[model samples]
Target: MGMNEHDQTKYIFAQSIKDLMAKQPLDKITVTDIVKHSGMTRQTFYRYFQDKYDLVNWYFEKLADKSFRQIGNSSTLKEGLVKKFTFLLNDQIFFMQAFQSKDYNNVENYDYQCILEFYKQIIHNKIGDIPEDIMFLLKMYCHGSITMTVEWAIRGMKESPEMIADLLIDALPPKLEDLLSDLR
Candidate 1:
């Protein structure tokens, strides 16, 4: 499908920030630089994203959508995780910088929300709505996973993507483990 004008505009900003990120850290990059690099106006950039960090989160979400949407009947969850870790490893520099932010809307927080929702959907499909206590456990699982992932990226990702994926899946809580057993 063809991208709408809005998506095209977002891509323009995304590319501009990505190019600038290669030259400097994310904190060093500014909205003016992104707009100028894209040959767009500050008003246009603000219309699309609140700040560069928001754009970064959007970029990560876009990547997640592409990577996680394929996790279905044909693909195992571990395979999906391998794809995710490999994607992050391939863009280690960009992600390393992204994960350095301690802001409220940091990439880690975004990742937790995405992962929690992803697994919640899987459970919903398997058994219907999750109970509050079980949902709490799931949240804890996602939070720990995201924290470990951020640390993994910050540590220069010394571990292999496959190894990390395997380790993460193995760390699943027992209830979630049983729920997702078929996917493994």
Candidate 2:
């Protein structure tokens, strides 16, 4: 499906917020700054997003969707996770800004939830049947993955995405080894 004008405005707001965040914290940024940066009016900004937080949250949702789409094609689900981190590395500026935001716990916040849910979907696709009985365990995997990845991001991502991918693979619980281990 194509993006409508409202979605386009959201994109505009997202980019504008990212740009502003590069020079300031999230709390300091207001709707006016986002609209001014995007060259849109405040009313138009409000029509699409209630606040800067909404814009940032929505932005992460879109990014998660895009990243998940690519992850689906990876050779192994683990490899796809590395690819997702690499995607964030490619957008380091924004992620770093998000990482630095005040009142934000990158691993325990809205953006973290988006990434977690994306990973959950990937796990469901791989197993083909995510029974309700194991839902908590599935969420645990998602939370652990997002937490580890965001921790790396917050610490400047010293390890390359490939290395982080390998670490994540090594860190998987023994029970999941059969499910996530590479078949080839």
Candidate 3:
């Protein structure tokens, strides 16, 4: 709450976008609408972001930073995923609106890549001996997991975050969770 003017403006802009997203799609929300909701001038919005897409990317990057710390510090990967998904569900309206857009293909999506990198770090830490081949395998699994997550998110996330996390954990190769849990 001790935010300076710059920080407060950014927060206002982000919250404005999130609020607008709950009512309409991203494509329909314009710079004007954002400025209006944020109670800022056009120049102010441009000062902080290139466009709504840039704001969206910044939002995802912020989530990724928080999620990475949670995952890295977690005792188990499943615990980490549950924490991450719980974070997402807190802003489910904005996430659903973002997903409903035709903009984010799995490959081009910020959230997807962020999840992939998060899992890669998890896999890297779980293994004692690292091999180049194994790293690729881990990346492959991360990619697949992120892709599936995107699908689940786009479906309105009908399942609870814990349920989704447990389902994802269950899908991992047999003994992988045991191996990771052992490392912890």
Candidate 4:
């Protein structure tokens, strides 16, 4: 499908940010730099994004959506969780630096929402009635897992994504365990 002008501009801007992120801290990056890198005028940049923070938020949101879609059809919760985290940690060094920067503070919350929505869909599909307590537990697990993942990536994803996924699967609640096992 052809991308609209807005999407094209947004894509260029996002690529600019990703390119700059490798060379400098997020705080050090400016809209001017983005414009220059993207080969778009400053006015064009402003037309698409209010500021760099807005661009950062949009980038993370897009990544989260992509990750969720990639793992949305897993047969087991363990597999789903692993796929999700694996996607997040795949760009380990970039994410580690990006998530730690002040510019990306909202990225964590955005990621959390994505994780919640992804699991909510899965739970709703598997069992129409997901108890409130179970829902809460699942949310907590998602947040905790992502938090640990952020820390791990920052610390250098020293271990493999599979190892992290295994640890997370081992920590699942009994209800989740049963659900995931049943799927397997």
Give residue 150's error in model 4 in angstroms.
0.5
Give the 10-residue window scoring lowest on summed lDDT in candidate 3.
175-184
lDDT (Cα atoms) of all candidates against the true structure: 0.86, 0.72, 0.73, 0.75
Which has the greatest TM-score? Answer: 1
TM-score of 1: 0.89
My TM-score estimates for the predictions, one after another, are 0.89, 0.79, 0.81, 0.81
Q: After superposition, how far is residue 183 of candidate 3 from its true place, in Å?
A: 6.9
**Preferred candidate (lDDT higher): 1 or 2:** 1
Q: Model 2 Cα displacement at 166 (Å)?
A: 1.1
RMSD of each: 1.9, 3.3, 3.0, 2.7
Weakest ten-residue segment in model 1 by summed lDDT: 66-75
lDDT agreement of model 1 with the native: 0.86
Candidate 3, 140: how far from true, in Å?
3.1
TM-score of 3: 0.81
Q: Is candidate 1 or candidate 4 better by lDDT?
A: 1
Best-to-worst ranking by lDDT: 1, 4, 3, 2
Report the C-alpha lDDT of model 2 over 1-184, residue by residue, as the tens digit.
8889888878888888888888887778888788888999988887877677778777776876778456656778677777678878987777776766656533247755765565556556667776664566556766787678767877888899889888878777765656556522
Candidate 4 lDDT, 9-56, residue by residue in tens: 898898888888888887788898999999999998888788887887
Candidate 1 lDDT by residue in tens digits, 110-177? 88888888888889988898999889889988988988999999899999988998998899888888
Candidate 1: segments with Cα more than 4 A from true spot: none
Mark the regions of model 3 whose C-alpha exceeds 4 Å error after superposition.
104-108, 125-132, 174-184
